[model samples]
Target: MLHFFKNLKIFAKILSLSTLLLLFVIIVAAYSLNQTVLLSDKLKSLSKEEIAFLGVANEVSTLQLEKNIYIERALRLILKRKFNESASFFDGSEPVVNKHNLQLIKKTTEGVQVGLAEIDKLVVNLLSKQWSAKIEKNIVNIREDFNKLKGEIVEFDAKVQAFFAASNISSELIEGEILQLERQQDTIDEHIISLMAGVERLTLDIIQESEQLESSAVKRTVIFTLVSVLVGTCLAFMIAKNIRVNLNKGISVAQQLSSGNLAVSFVANQQQDEVGQLLRELELMSQHFRKVLSKVTESSMHISQLASTLSNNTSDTAKDTEAQQSGIEQIASSITEMVSSIQEVSKNAHVAAESTQHADQQATEGHDIVSGVTESISTLVTSVENTSEVIKQLAKETANVESILDVIGSIAEQTNLLALNAAIEAARAGEQGKGFAVVADEVRSLALRTHESTQQIQTLIRNLQQQASNSVTKMDEGCTYAAETVQRATKAEASLKNIASAVNTINSMNMQIASAAEEQSSVAELINQSVEDISHKTQLNAERTHQISKESHDLSSLAETLQSAVKQFKTN
Candidate 1:
């Protein structure tokens, strides 16, 4: 049974269990619903048919009693009227008494007929088939008896009406009519009792049938509910137990795998359930891990062997690298000394070039100084020539001033002759001539001073002209001297230019020598750098070889450790 459940899929297993429980629930619900429907039908019959039948029966019985009372009251009134020999038993009229009794009896009879009709309807619509036939028969009998009683009441009312209508009624006739009515009353009472008994009996039967149906329906519902509960409990326990057992097996297998036991065996049957599939996958995983571990073990052993061989090869290479490094160091030392000697030669050549440049600069400055002196001397000669021309112009301007002074002297002499003639004419005119003579005397004295002043001016002019002439001559001499000095300075400037040119030639040769020395220095430095680079590369190679040897030894150790770690996993 477990194997069958295990072979089912996970969904199918759960679905089967649920189906079983659901089936039980459906059966219980269906049965209970059916029972409830039966009970409900019985209750509906009791409420709508059986209970209505009983109510209608009770109403018929009451109406029958009312009819009998009305009939009896009518008979009593007729007896009273017969015994008392009165015309009416009530209201002072025999016809009125008879009509009142007939109206009451007819009303009660109509009510009884209506109740019987309702009872007949209840019996026709009865839900209980077993009671329908018997109840229908009882209602038919009741209707027949009620009909005969109604006929008797009508016949008695007619006779009473006829008796009351006769004005000359005999006592014996009255007695005979009364006796007949009494007999009819007895029959009516018997009919009423029979109708009531039949209705009561029908009511009792309906009650009993309803109670039986309710009891049976309750029993069926209880039994089915208990059966469903029991079946569902058993199914749930079975499905849960099956699943738990399989899951426990899967847990055991997982525990073993967790402990790193790759060699542990897992066996599974052809179960398609979830726990079964999980166990199968675990078994596959264990097998795959076993194969991987086997390969890793073999690879680790091979790695250890290769690491040992690498260590030996690196050691031999390290020895060769050390010897090569020593030879490179010796060659580097010789090249370094050669580079130092070339650097010293380059330094001395650079100093000589700088000294030559300084000498050329001094020679150029000396040439510039001689040229500046020559320009100054030429400038001075031009200034002296301009000053000599200015002095010659001053001498000519002084001669023109002397000629103007001579013209002023001649005008002064003409005024003196005019004043003398005025004085002589005043001597001839007496006192008037005396006044004219005084004015003439003052005029003559002014003209004489003017002539004397003109003579002094001509003399000063001559002195000025002579000084100007002397300055011209002195400036001419100074100009000649300046011209000679300028010639000497120009000759000196030419000599200095020749010296500067020779110094520049020597500076150019020195620059060429310096440039050649710099080229040689650069070439020697390049050779020295090549030697240093080779020495550095050789030293680096030796160091790297030693590092490789050490790393190879470490690699062998790591491979052995890896092999030991892999040994812990049992692959076979």
Candidate 2:
């Protein structure tokens, strides 16, 4: 029975229960209505038949009594006529006999006749109904008695009329007629008594039948009501218990899901009820969640491993960047020293040109001075060659720095891409990956900053390379001027007469060399400053790379944490 109810849909179950209760109510109502109709019919029967019979019978009895009184009065008048022999028959009581007494008797007999007619009509009506055999038999007996009493009343009335008619006869004749009328009256009274007895019997029988019908109606109504109540109560309890059990099962499954027990299972059934559908949906939801969490777990693990690898790579890159920055700083110091050396060469060239002017004033010391000038010019040439070589080396080193900057820029771009990928994965993880998303954003920002710094460094390196190329060009010009000064010094040594001219030319060349040397020194100073800026930028880049490495480690940690969180759900 429970299985049958369970198999039914929720609406069907409730409707079935209501229908049953309604059917029982309808049955009870119909039975009550039928009983009411039966009782109403019995009441109507009592009013129309038994009670009418009793009323007419009573009216008949009253008429019979009045007729009897009238007959007795007539009898007394006859007796009085027998006793008063001296008076005429129609003497003092003539008005009494003709007008009052006979008229009253005649009127009473007519009333009795009317009552009998009514009684006969009621009897015919009762017989037509075809009631119980016992009631019908009683009614038939009452009808027969009424007929007999009616015949007796007619005989008595005729006798009274005969007595009244024979008024001028003898007293003996009047007494004989009076005696006959008295016997007739006695017979009529006997029949009246029998008729009344039959009416009473029939009345009692109808009363008994009504009482039995009322008792049966009461007993049946109570029995049906009790049966309906018991059956309804049992049905309600069974339906409620079935519904409660199923609802409780659904609640249990929901509770399990709420508590994050993805491993919870629910058995499916063929029931098409609302609760069954809910349970099925919950089962599907649990399965879907389990699958999703399992995938999340695997993805988190992979992300963690990738983050770790990224962190390690980032750390190595940061170290390489730091080493590169240190090398660049050393190059900047070397360039500073080279700039100082170039300024010293410019000063020596000036002092050598002063010595050449002194040689023009003292011609006898001209040869020795020219020898000293030639040696100074040769040394200046050697210095210029050295400066040119240094400038070329600086340009080469600048090119190397540009290549390193390119590598750093590439690393920064790669880091940014990795951060972007991490952010995407974190987004895929939903609310669980909110913290990881924040970390990914931070990493991306750092990578962006690193990329910007790399770009700035590359710009600075390009400027430094441009400055180095300019410096190399200036150094080559200084070298050519030194070689020309050396040739002029050798010519001055061979001809004393043109020594003055040669000294002036040497002074002019020395001034030009000094100016070029000063310009080169300035360019070297600018180059040195640019190199320092590049070194500063490199340091900053290295620091950002280190930060990127740290962020990657944090990202790896976050991935591990996410994996751990997903592990709490027993998916698979």
Candidate 3:
């Protein structure tokens, strides 16, 4: 019942402990009370029985004194020749002695009783011898054989009277009678002495009996007191130790939680008490949190992968755009050179026509100018074919870059999904997941940034493709202009000299477009490097999440242990 109370609610536990202490005190008090009653009874018995025993012993002593006084009186009477009076005194003292002897039998033990019996026998023998001696003495005093001598002796007796009775006897006869009387008196005195000795022996026996009784009583009381004290100390120690154990368990739990070491294991107590219930609930909560963190960690890893792919595609697209811009500038420079050759061709043709006086020489000069024009036109055709090859290469590279960007965008979308899952998990974990959630957010932001950079690279790639297409168109226009200049150099020389400045302006604009594309490619490379950094961080975050999951499992195990430990206490 006490165990049941101790495992109950807090208030009940305190009450139970207090009740146990009170009960212990009550038990000790009861033991003392019982001892007290027993001692009181023993004391009462001692007061009644022992006091009565002593009183009887004292009465015996008083009787012995009275008998001694009576014996003295009896001896005086015997000396006066009044034997009857002495016998009367002896008889009067006998009752007191007999009464004392009988009382010893009633109040005292075996040894005192034996002495009283011996005293009674001695008193009877002494009285019997006294009677016999008294008769003998009287016989000697009377004359029975001679009648005349009897009458004369009677007359002599009357003259001496009772005063001379002791002297009239012969010296030898009187001495003999006195000796016999003295022997009888000595026997009586010895009997009185033996009776007094018996009384003293009885008193000594009573005293020894009282001391033994007192010693026994003391021994019993002391033994009981010692047992009670031992029991009380054991009860107190057990109660104190029990409380200490429970308090220590509570402290251990608090310390483990504070350190973020959820993996602490202890025996979970089976009791359904308040503390047990609380610890059990905590274990369940930790388990749930651990599971949620696991899923979040998996999702974060998937997002990190997508972000990496996006960075790769954006960097590839930027390189291709930079290549296409390089090709357009080469084509523009070819167009400018072809135009300069046409101007020179027109100038030489005019010089040849001015020398009419020397027709043969002028015709020869025109032929040489025609040959130079044909060489210039051949170079222009070669430049146009090379620009067409460059445009085709730019188109192919642009298509590849676009495909890679599409893949990056798709991965970015998937990362967003994983980030969403991580956020949900972090929310469930509450305060514990706050730091993890921040990392997840960073991953999401990097994914978005990579996506945005890919989009910019795509736009730039598109612009480069457009510029490449325009350069092809310009190359075709340069072809037409080159053909027309060839025709005009054959037919006339004035038109070819007019177009050299336009070719110079187109070449300058192409160089500026290549420079801008190079700058854009550099920006894309920087974004790709940032994506790599973010990917590395994401990987680290995933690892940390796994660690957290493992810790959560440990916490769950600890909760189970705490539950088991708590079960040892009986709540029922």
Off by over 4 Å in 3: 1-239, 254-268, 272-572
Q: Look at candidate 2 and give me any clashing residue pairs.
A: none
**lDDT agreement of model 1 with the native:** 0.76
Candidate 2, residues 14-107: lDDT per residue as tens digits? 7987898888888878887898888788668867776677787778778778877877776676567568764554555464544677788788
The lDDT leader among the candidates is: 2
Give the per-residue lDDT of model 1 (tens digit) for 333-444.
Answer: 8877877887787787778778877888888888888888888888888888887888888788888888888889999999999988888888899976788899999999
lDDT at 289 for candidate 3? 51
Let me know the TM-score candidate 2 reaches against the reference structure.
0.50
What is the C-alpha lDDT profile of model 3 across 50-114, one tens digit per residue?
Answer: 34434544453454344334433433444444433333323344446434543443343333334
lDDT against the true structure, per candidate, is: 0.76, 0.81, 0.55
Off by over 4 Å in 1: 1-4, 72-98, 127-204, 218-241, 248-252, 266-268, 294-562
Model with the higher lDDT, candidate 1 or 3 = 1
Better of 2 and 3 by TM-score: 2
Q: Which ten residues in a row have the lowest lDDT in candidate 2?
A: 89-98
